[model samples]
Target chain A: MNTNTQTTRLYHSTLSPFCRKVRLVLAEKKIEVELVEEKYWENPPDLKRRNPAGKLPVLRHRGHMLAESQAIVEYLDEVVADPALMPRQPLDRHEVRRLCAWFDDKFNSEVTQPIMNERVWKKITRSGYPDSRAVKDGLRAIKEHIDYLTTLLEARRWLAGNAISLADFTAAAHFSCLDYISDVDWDRSEAVRDWYATIKSRPAFRSVLADQVPGIHPAPHYAELDFG
Target chain B: MNTNTQTTRLYHSTLSPFCRKVRLVLAEKKIEVELVEEKYWENPPDLKRRNPAGKLPVLRHRGHMLAESQAIVEYLDEVVADPALMPRQPLDRHEVRRLCAWFDDKFNSEVTQPIMNERVWKKITRSGYPDSRAVKDGLRAIKEHIDYLTTLLEARRWLAGNAISLADFTAAAHFSCLDYISDVDWDRSEAVRDWYATIKSRPAFRSVLADQVPGIHPAPHYAELDFG
Candidate 1:
């Protein structure tokens, strides 16, 4: 057990998109953090003590245990000024947040959650066999999401706007998770594929790219910067 | 159809806590909005056009259709400035957002969504009869939440801290929905009940108090300021 209470530590699961978002932001902001993989599925007793909500991606920073990925990332952006993830104008910020919610809530529910539950979690937790129907549904849903992203990319340089904001990282986080399991059809949309390639090459994404979840090997092109 | 595009409009469902949270913030800032009730259950085709995510509480303001309740409220707070709902310090803001997410995500999942799905939506959509077991589960889950709120109230004047912020509104939004159906056991925690009373009596709460959903009458004491 590390006795240093001052050290910024993140309690997270490697494959969880929420945790990965926080990790990416922390890296993007050049903040040093010790990542502690938390098996939230087991209902770790201390998880409740650390966070009343008892959710993952809890950050122990500056004596505060921060929970909720969006809140934590926003806080980091606020505290650390350089390379800001949020935009200046209220409307721009709203666009960023709206997209963040879109990915976190809608995309997660529609694409990530069902597929991850079927493929990754069921295998890791030994819960059950993957439901092909659920996986197929998630795969089908991702096509629409990819099309939407392509449309957005055509209009703006990034998902929310011209600049690469938290929305990009958020969207990338979900895509990366699915990509790890070889679920994403990178060839589906040229623009989305290009966007992912651009974001994937960022230094901030390095830590995430190097992640190794036991028993689940990364897809051949998962960490390839030029893949697809 | 209202031709006044300049007039602010809110596409919402009366019972949705997400929409109600945005409404509370708008009312607190005294932003007059034309309420356009959207029967999202029927999958209004334009809902997708208005908001790609196709969720309700979509606010059409300043010619932009803003989606996501938290994002819209935060944007309102930023643009309005007066009657600020967010705290000053980054830490304080984070606390407010954390609690807001706690209610919106955690509380909604455990308490609001299940109960409303079984008790309210089923009846409204004529989908099926209420499932007593699901309703009971939500009712049971809410007790733990009330207890947690009681603990938080013991330490601070509001849900986040000494000052009233979006956290309070977010929490009150969910509670109000449950309270409408006479689901909340206000007797569980005096502290929580008192908190609700304080928030309920605010002028901003008027429109929400007056809400009347077709085929589903509110509980007799739902609108009473001194209900508990």
Candidate 2:
């Protein structure tokens, strides 16, 4: 069994939205973590050892190995109660989780996964060249997603509700990854742009903003807090 | 706004593992619910109105709309705490969630989705014919998954631990769907077979046992309590 310690460490991939969500939550809760980037696609022996499921964003804290980005983020929020990432009411909490799934599951399949697979993973993993059709489809899908998010933001202060919750972090994580590759059209939705700018300027986003993926340059405004 | 009543209604599909999971949880909690079968692929007008994500397994309770199977199940466990689906300790709870994700995300992708897409959805949705390669791949993947689950059962009575938690229900949900199409080769792993038999015998599983998708038939042993 791994010994318990005050230290927290996360095994992650820099460009993964799932990993970024965990990082953002940890940062928001003021938890210090040592980030170790793992090349999970190569079937690293330690990766499966750390998480039996062999997934990224495996967090080792207080002698427990936590996997599943949503589960880990919720655990972090529970353990660190001062800045709660989930709302108090059950109905409101359901909304937070529902939206989290929207981004992690739906948005990812529709936009982030396909786009990254075509433009990013192909280059990083030495796979075939980008498929223009897949990229075009992802770009097209993202517009509808942005419009949906714009509608959500127009009513609520944050994605889930009035408070800044894990849903915002989850959505931002996916958006940031697409933004890194300059796939997002900032001119598309003013509401979404404003929401992004507000979240991007937070202290929790600093480390993510500083992410430097090898051989793939970030967009010029990727790290700029005042991009809006 | 929908009127609040004593009624708890679930909008779901027969073959969906996610819907099965919610059914199992609600039944375990002894919450009486009305199951409404929905053709989500057809994108019925009320589907999006009920839940903006337009996903199945949307539970309507006390006039609150709940989407995302995991979120709904968790909410049910929280609100109806008599037969708690989640463990008490954070570590144990994390393990439960991790295993839940294991079955829901990894196992679903590698086994259920591929197999179901080929065998079931194509027939129901009138899409292309089943790809033999995809079905073969899903069958091949389930072998390794069964082995893994067998190992976990060797160490612990249940998938997550000694107690039957949401992980067990989540896993059984997926397995039940595959079993419905007579896809599972239960003879491969005695341990997994025993686990399924144990979960399947529970009273909560009765409704799922009685499920009959149109034009598709359940295996002979699907509803048998003494299948083991």
Candidate 3:
């Protein structure tokens, strides 16, 4: 364990969308963090000690242990204002948060969790063979989600509104995870593809695009800036 | 079908913890909201139109549709200043959010969802009879959660800190739902029971106490202030 109290440290998993959201915000805000990949599924004894809830994406900053990705990202935005992830107006901030929850909760249930469970976790944990039915359901659900994003992007520059905010990063975080195993049907919507392409090209997204999960390989176009 | 946009209207379900959390915060802020019970499980056509994600607890305030319980509650707190639900300090606010997620995510998954699904939802939706194994597992999980809350209350007056915050309401939301069906073993932890008693006695909790789902009955001691 790195005992540098001055610097921030994050314990997270590679493909977990929740952890990726925090990492995106950290990188976006230009906050240099020491990333420690934690295999929380194995039930490490110290994991519960770090976070009583025993969840991942735990951040240790200024000697305070912060759990919950949404909460941690919001804290980072509050403390560091260089590139604000949240908007100034309460309504706009609410929109940002609503979309964040949409991805973290609804999208996760319908798409990320199911897809990852079948495709990624089954392979990594050696739990069982990938359930084709679950994977198909997740794939089918993604089309509707992509269409929804396309509708949102048609009216605004970002997920929440015109300005780039936490909503964009939050959506991108989930998309990046799904993209890792080539689950996303990028060809379905031009608007969504454009939106992802713009967000993916950002310097903050570099760390996420460069991620390689031990045996799993990223899609051919996962790292490309001009994939479209 | 209330067309009055002047009055804040919340389309929600009676027993959902997410909806209850929003209702609690709104009541805490002294915000009089018109509640319209939505049958979200049936996926009403307007539900998808109101919230693209097709979830309940959609708050229409100032002609803007707001989804996501946590985000909606946070917005209400920000917009209304009296009896602030969030602390002023960044770290303190983070603690509040962390606990909110702890209940909404962890507690919901472990205790509320399974127990409610088996005991309440099955009955309400007329799907099937309660699954004993699932209910037993959920009941078993609650003891550990109550113990954890007992430990938290030992240090502070409230869940997150000395003063009442969103964390308290978020926790009470889940507990209130479980309490409705008598799923919570309040006798397991005196500290947790005391904490619940204190929060449950507040005016904000009245709306939750008055909650009546169609066929399912609330526990006899559910509404009593002196249950302990």
Best by DockQ: 1
Candidate 2, DockQ to 2 decimals? Answer: 0.74
RMSD of each: 0.9, 2.2, 1.2
Candidate 1 vs 2: which has more TM-score: 1
List of chain B TM-scores, one per candidate: 0.98, 0.97, 0.98
lDDT, residue B149, candidate 3: 88
List candidate 3 stretches off by more than 4 Å: none
Worst 10 residues of 2 chain B by lDDT: B1-10
Pairs with steric clashes in candidate 3: none
iRMS, candidate 1, in Å: value is: 0.4
Estimate every model's Cα lDDT from 0 to 1: 0.94, 0.92, 0.92
Question: What would the per-residue lDDT of candidate 1 be over residues A45-155, giving only the tens digit for each residue?
Answer: 999899889899899998889999999999999999889899999999999999999999999999999999999999999999999999999999999999999999999
Kept native contacts, as fractions per model, are: 0.89, 0.63, 0.89
lDDT of 3 by residue, B1-228 (tens): 568887899999999999999999999998889999987888888999998888988999988999999999999989998898899999999999999999999999999999999998898888999999999999999998998988998899999999999999999999999999998888998888999999999998898898888789999999999998
lDDT winner between candidates 1 and 2: 1
> TM-scores of the first chain across all predictions?
0.98, 0.97, 0.98
Among incorrect, acceptable, medium and high, the docking class of model 1 is: high
TM-score of each: 0.99, 0.96, 0.98
